[model samples]
Target: MTAQTGYQDHKTDRLARLRRVESQVRGVTRMAAEDRQYIDVLTQINAATHTVQEVALGLPDDHT
Candidate 1:
């Protein structure tokens, strides 16, 4: 789901999303380190990538 940032972007919202992505990355890293199945790790990697991309797309286009 795409978020509408408009003029006043919510700091808490952005931080929360970033934190979620960070947690996802950490989990994927741990899974890989523990020699988890390649397919399983790849699935998580794809999920994380999709989440990060979604967050990136939600950012406002205007710099100001």
Candidate 2:
């Protein structure tokens, strides 16, 4: 699903969303470093993965 238009107006919003995903990834790294329980770490990893996927999927929609 390629977007036919550019997201010029949504640049700020898209960047903000990416920043949030980056933060989520950092949190996951911290959890692992802190020796968190396996399930807890896995849960956070899943959440981060889902967030990234959402952002990726939104790109084409937003551009359109």
State the lDDT of candidate 2 residue by residue for 1-64, as single tens digits: 8654566677777787778878988988998999999899888778878877876787788666
**Which portions of model 2 miss their true places by more than 4 Å?**
1-5
Instruction: Give the worst 10-residue stretch by lDDT in candidate 1.
Output: 4-13
Give per-model TM-scores.
0.71, 0.73
List ranges where model 1 is wrong by over 4 Å. Answer: 1-8, 61-64
Among these predictions, the greatest TM-score belongs to 2
Per-residue CA lDDT of candidate 1, range 3-57, in tens? 7556346556767777888898999899989999999989888888887786677
Cα RMSD (Å) between model 2 and the true structure? 4.5
In model 1, the Cα lDDT at residue 38 comes to: 94
Backbone clashes counted, model 2: 0
Candidate 2 collision pairs:
none
